[model samples]
Target: MSHLEREIAEQPQVLRTLLRAQAAPVGAIAAAIKRFQPAFVQIAARGTSDNAARYAQYLMGIVLRMPVGLAAPSVHTLYGAQPNLARALVIGISQSGKSVDVLQVISDARAQGALTLSITNDANSPLAQAAEYHIPLHAGEERAVAATKTYTAELAAVALLVTALADDDAMRAALNAVPDALDATLTLCDPIAGWAQRYRYMPQLACIGRGYNYCTAFEINLKVTELCYITGVGFSEADFLHGPIAQISPGFPVLVVAPSGKTLPTLLTFLEKLKARQAEALVIASDEAAFVHAQQQMRIPAATPEWLTPITAVMPGQVFAMQLAAAKGYDLDNPLGLTKVTLTL
Candidate 1:
């Protein structure tokens, strides 16, 4: 079995359940919010962590109406951006609580008066200690350097932060149900893996989303390139029409993440345009019936409150990238030229 196929094969029990259990940390983040609510919020991460943090930053600024910033660990240590350190709630997202650059960024945030919080799998790592407050991801020592469970746990932290900021108790309840929904999403991993292996040779692919998931497109694109050594691009549904449409040629796959959200209509409209352009589209949609296609559709569970779609929607691409790499006999546990922990401090 391919590394991704094996990961998917194991999803029926262990790691998938680990991904589902993310709600456990949500309560801790809620408590952290009550303890530290700064005017500005900054996220610390590197590479994939930064990709996840970018999604969280969008959720904070656009979803929760908070002043959120993406803190580059190098900028604080190398150039020294005081703007991120001033009264900001710096949340560091690292699988290992010891990423050198992420730690320095959080430490700098603290030195300049920002409230620091670290969400990491390693409870005892230095990154955890650097934060004034800590909400450990508890993904339980993910060995795969590609980082699946840790990514899900970080988004749980983001959802927890958003839920805590909202005054609506009903929304909090809705947010709490995400893990169960995520449990259902794990079922599609194998199907996505099957597709990735079959389509590995495709030169280009599209990963599109809207609102908060617009950032998911970037992260997904990153993963595909990082793992599969193939080129893929992520964009918003609205942004595709402006210029990118010209690039949609035959045999090019368009992977659309269409969750049933406020932007569904716009995304569907964009897909229709792709269809009219005669481009092959493989939609990873919750409402699969809404889209008719000759190729099989891999549908995950629907996302509630619409905003949390990115949390579930990104999983398929995560699996797809790994599967594509695994198809080429690449070991996903540690992709070449990648490290478990990145420390630049």
Candidate 2:
């Protein structure tokens, strides 16, 4: 195993601690978001932050019934916006709050009259200093650059924030129990890492998820690209069958963050198509339907409320990425050309 992999393997205990440590702030941030209640909510992040952006958008739309939009950090500062950004509530998420672009945009948003909030791991970082409110993930020092606990913590933090805003008692309960969900997901680590090590060289990998796990699919692709430096894509299962299936052939590996909702029938249909194409496939799910089979499988504990399966489903994938990167001796702690924070315009 690479140094980063060893570091990650040693991290679950620490991660569990971080998860327990941040519950209050997570809840508080959600409540703070509700208080803002601006004309609209704007999210900014590059790469993985972009993944987080998608999750934020999904949750706000799916769970909170709010309209959430995405904006790159550059647009608020350098790109020039047509509409007044003055009343928009912008929440910029960065693991390290100091990236040049992120900082510039937070300043621009403020100058235009928007309420800016920074969700970061470092409260002392530039991005955190620029925003009016800071929701630190409290994830502590992440040793490997390819984020693991920090990203999960950020997801939990966002969930807490949204739950607070929408008076979602059910979601609030989910947030409280998330660490347990995370633990259940971790149990699949050995199996997932085995897959990663075995398939490290597989060409053209695809990941699919429906509903909330869609964001998890995005995150898995991000980890693969950043660490293993592979060409990977995350798509909705149904959408993939429509056009993307042409790219899948023998030896191509696919990952499905199988949905637990009504989408299961659709997922199984897509799986059949994948089978017909003779492509390799992996599925992550918890449903105990009367029938189930796949080319490869990683099962997480069944999560409550079904749509929240992403909370549990993403753990093994993160571990899988870490192990694959470790096998290649890739630097997981600090991925090439990236930092803990991006203070952008």
Candidate 3:
């Protein structure tokens, strides 16, 4: 197997390993967060890690009732502006702890008396050293240029932190079961490969989701774009209806991450509209009924909690992107002009 495919297959064990190793440290970080009692949160990340931050934005907001914002690193790196963060909890997320811009954000936030934490695969790396608290991903070394294990490990890290903060026993139990859920989700690989072959010639497409899986939409879109060299776009189900809906032409492909949740009703309605416009939809959902309007359907583990679905939902996307890139005869381990670690200023 290729490095990318092996890394993708390793995610179930990665989550199992991460939760087993980092639970106590994550709890300690949660304890520190509560003691600090920050007014709000700001996260700095880039590329795929940024998509994981989007998961945190919704997770923190829904569970902790804390307002979270994605930090614009250029504000500090380019403009040299220091915004007041004295009452904030600043977080930095990166697969490699080598992003200089992300490191600068943590350093600046610490200088401003903000409580800073970092989630990264490397505990000895610079970004980990800069934060007051750190949660190691325990994902080990990822040799693939496109991240699969590390990205899921990042989401698990974020989910672990939030679950600890809430101190909810039931949610913590749910978190423990995620590895099995991921294993079950991986069973869809053969079907995903078939789907990828069916769309091997696809030049462009749209990915849509809402609530927590909103991050899934963006992450999957990035995977396809980078690995398969497709012009993929991501959108929230609500936002797609506003102006971009007009762009849909006959036989256009749309990938929808529609797990069984509060957003399912609205997504069903959105699927109806896609049908009316002759847009074909491939839905990644737990609800078998959701396939009523879809041209293709990939099922995830049905028992995973809605909040934790992103951890499992992303498997099919990763598999599809990997399969699609292989079908297109592209190198899976290294994409053109891309490296394992990108340190942006």
* TM-scores for all predictions: 0.86, 0.88, 0.99
Q: Per-residue lDDT for 262 in model 3?
A: 89
Clashes of each: 2, 21, 0
Q: Which candidate tops TM-score?
A: 3
lDDT of 3 by residue, 116-137 (tens): 9999999999999999999899
Question: Who wins the lDDT comparison?
Answer: 3
Query: Per-residue lDDT of 237-309 in model 2, one digit per residue for the tens?
Result: 7688789888888767888887577777788877777778777777877775412547677777766556556
Per-residue lDDT tens digits of candidate 1, residues 1-345?
A: 434444433433433343356444545655666666677787878766776787787777875788877775667677766554666788888878778778887777788877788877777889888887776665555666676666766776666667666656786677667766767877765676556668767777777777777767777787887777767787877888788888888666877777787777888778777777777777767786536642546576765567777767777777777767777777777777877776675
Steric clash pairs (candidate 3): none
Off by over 4 Å in 3: none
Error of 2 at 191 (Å): 2.3
